[model samples]
Target: MSLKELLKKKETAIVAQWFDRVVNTYQLDTSRFLKSQKDAFANPVGNTLLQGLKAVFDETTDRMDNETVISFLDPIIRIRALQDFSASKAVGFVFFLKEIIREQTAKETQGNAALQAEMLLFESKIDELALTAFDIYMQCREKVYEIKANEVRNRTFTAFHRAGLVADWEEEPRH
Candidate 1:
């Protein structure tokens, strides 16, 4: 498939918006990221994942450099620990990345079959299919589940709620 065909309106804009947010979000706690301490470690794993994903899924290039996008993506990728398929977080990353990319692609591509095929092709870029982007997302999600479960077990959340650590939406969202 041609590059232009692969990068449709939905996918392109969504990818662009996400890239922008990743780089521009100032309040983003670097601590939330895994490889936040690594320097421009030459294609730092996250950058490679994001850039490679862009090249494979997107065709346009406006303000975001491939490297910059990669830098933003690196932490996300690390959080998923895609490189370590055995890691618990890999599933969450895959689901998150895939949903984000797929949503963007759907918005831009209008759910085109051609675009879907192109996206399927991009999956090959990931080192392990089992460790795909969606998988990483699932892993993260599972981790969150585990944490919440622990909190419930220890009644930490109850204590926190009693201590007024809950949000003001009225109550904490159910897991």
Candidate 2:
């Protein structure tokens, strides 16, 4: 694969793809959504949606266009889409946030430093955030999968406190 392809294989691209999913939640396809850009800023509700669209669009990549903002003094909100991520960190963490993206977008986004520095900083932060989120997922899964400790000890040579059945002394009482 080319460098672009490789970068796309990284999490930054995957993260951008997630934006694509979020954008469509409004029933607007990418091309159609962007096509409505100008009119989007023309009305009150249309303008609010437009602002959200621009923020998410800018978040998906490191670039922005003046046309993105309909007019003066638009708010610069941090979308937190990409965290400060290293290439290696991305390789390690991308899948943790998989629930955030749709499958098809999983292709195409590999990104590069070509994006603005601020964008790069946001993407890079994925390293830490991914790890933290994954850890939470693992802990929840562990508790969910935890087996009730077999209380075989109650009927064994040594008496143990537990409900139903006796367990070997070697078995721990806690999950």
Candidate 3:
């Protein structure tokens, strides 16, 4: 069977393994909560992550469009970006899929050279997906920084205004 067919057959197991790998990135208690909580409201991060992984896997196995993949990646990466993770850790979840796919398909592709080649191509697509995820991560970080900077600016302006050291432009005489 082709690599795509093999991947399709093993999709559930691969995605579950991929989700576990991602949850493992968190602290022990948080990881356990994320893994055990199935409710979307109570475990939004876990829900978004599992859904994103499944969608990304489907895209990788099929069309692999950059935009569609980014849409799936945004929520997961955004949550990580807002957390204390470094850029690598934030985007590293994408790489988990690669190892999961290899482990899931190893026995089937072991002696099949063509399936192995197809696996290589599929893994290359995953690399591209990771690149896209990194871009999304950076964008989310930039937005977070922008928000922080704006908050500081606003607070500074408020303080200055309260001290009568700064005035609104509208308070100035007409030029």
Give the winner by TM-score: 3
Off by over 4 Å in 1: 1-86, 90-95, 127-175
Please report, as a residue range, the 10-residue window in candidate 1 with the lowest summed lDDT.
26-35
Q: Please provide TM-scores, in order, for all candidate models, with all chains considered together.
A: 0.31, 0.26, 0.88
Q: Model 2: how far is 131 from its true place, Å?
A: 0.6
- Count of clashing residue pairs in every prediction: 27, 19, 0
Question: Across residues 6-59, which tens digit of lDDT does each residue of candidate 2 receive?
Answer: 334554554455434433333355435543556644433334434554453343
Superpose all Cα atoms of candidate 2 onto the true structure and report the RMSD in Å to 1 decimal. 16.0
When summed lDDT is taken over every stretch of 10 residues in candidate 2, the lowest stretch is 72-81
Q: Write the per-residue lDDT of candidate 1 for residues 1-175, one digit (tens) a residue.
A: 4424434535656555444444332235532241253344643543544454455344222333445444444456554443444444433333344556556555545656766666676544433433444444565567778888997866986787789877867575877
Top candidate, metric lDDT: 3
Error of 3 at 10 (Å): 0.4
Better model by lDDT, 1 or 2? Answer: 1
Question: Cα lDDT of all candidates, in order?
Answer: 0.48, 0.38, 0.90
lDDT of 3: 0.90
Better of 2 and 3 by TM-score: 3
